[model samples]
Target: MSKSKKSEFRPNDYVVYPAHGVGQIVSIEKQEVVGIELELFVISFEKDKMTLRVPTNKATEIGMRGLSSPDVISKAMTTLKGKAKVKRAMWSRRAQEYEQKINSGDLIAIAEVVRDLHRTDDQREQSYSERQLYEAALERLTREVAAVNGADEVAAAKQVGDVLISRAAAA
Candidate 1:
């Protein structure tokens, strides 16, 4: 058996794994592979119903991180209140950029995606791709907010939605 390494994360701690969103660290395990010992963090994504194991040492390099601070969340909400910066670029190019922002695991960037894609009165309806990107960013954002605020996804989503809606109404 491999030896366990002390980690900042503990069981029941919520963390973000870039490719995945919010997950709870269920446990730490040590395993031997080909006679090499590795310490891992076992995380569970309840919404995705998936479990992921990340090497303890590689967590930071791989963008695995703890919940966003209140200040970070505040900044993201401020970003949502800003006017949308829609580019004149093609949809394909914009979609690619949006996907990158969502996967960046940066709260502010994800909020930008949500702010830009959100539709308000007198605005045209979103295309299918736009909707998809918006929902993806929104989901990632809400999960992080939920983890930080100790709220469920729905409540977090509503909070984010309210910010967007009020901004839209003002615009």
Candidate 2:
């Protein structure tokens, strides 16, 4: 890769690479792959006990991005505490749209889904499909928050729940 196009990855950076979810940059190294010299972002995830070495130049190309800013994450938290926006549209249609957003690897979109699907106090039971989407969105959002906040997944999830629950009560 040309120096002009060199990777923006930095050591200790928290990045999300779509398919892999949350991963910590364990190291950056120069290695010869085949006949070319390449820089790699060494990322590790404990849940899968997997280590992925993504070529620096290919980071963005592979949907890798830095963690959201604290302010952005904070906004997402506030959104979670707000009322859900249930579209009266067909469930299958909404599900497809939500799935696309979730797979798009965007934190804000995932947060929107979490906020919109969240069931408040004494609400009717969620449909099976609704529960599935909520879980996926919540998982994705929490993983990114965990990476950005330097907290474990469970802790991050709890943090999200607390924020939303508090806001729900205040409403």
Candidate 3:
């Protein structure tokens, strides 16, 4: 690995994997793969009950990153309070966009997805796919919020929901 590519992650550190939301580095171990010794970060996603091994050298390249800072979290909260932007494009195309945003591991982009897809009780109901995408985006956002705030997922989710509700009332 290049000097700049040195591993910045350590065991027990919480990190965000682009496609997997938040996970902890449970350990760093070495294994022989194809006769080459590779160092891996063993990440455990408690919510999903899954374990992932990512090579240390490739962590940054794969978009695995440390948790978002407090400032970023605040920005995401502000984003949630903004108006929702629903495009007139077809649902399938929009859904693909939302999915990409959620998986991009960009907190602000995920917030945009949440804002765009949020529904108030009085608004027209969401279809099954819409509901699924909304929940996924919401979950991804809440997980990072929870990790950054050192709070439980439920509390983080409530905080996000409150922001959305306030936005709805203001609109």
Error of 1 at 79 (Å): 0.4
Q: Among these predicted structures, which one has the highest lDDT?
A: 3
Position 70, candidate 2: lDDT: 91
Model 3 is weakest, by summed lDDT over 10 consecutive residues, at: 1-10
lDDT of 3 by residue, 65-85 (tens): 999999999999999998888
Candidate 2 wrongly placed segments (more than 4 Å):
1-7, 29-38
- Candidate 3 local accuracy as lDDT? 0.94
lDDT of 1 at 105: 84
Candidate 2 per-residue lDDT, tens place, 1-171, comes to 455545476878778878767778999999998999998889987667999999988888778888889998988887776677879899899998888878877877788898888887587898999899898989989988887888888999999899878867876
Residue runs of model 3 more than 4 Å from their true location after superposition? none
Superposed Cα deviation of residue 68, candidate 2 (Å): 1.1
Task: For candidate 1, list the clashing residue pairs, or say none.
Answer: none
Show where candidate 1 strays beyond 4 Å.
1-6
Could you arrange the candidates by TM-score from highest to lowest? 3, 1, 2
Local lDDT at 91 for model 2: 89
**TM-score of each predicted structure versus truth:** 0.93, 0.79, 0.96
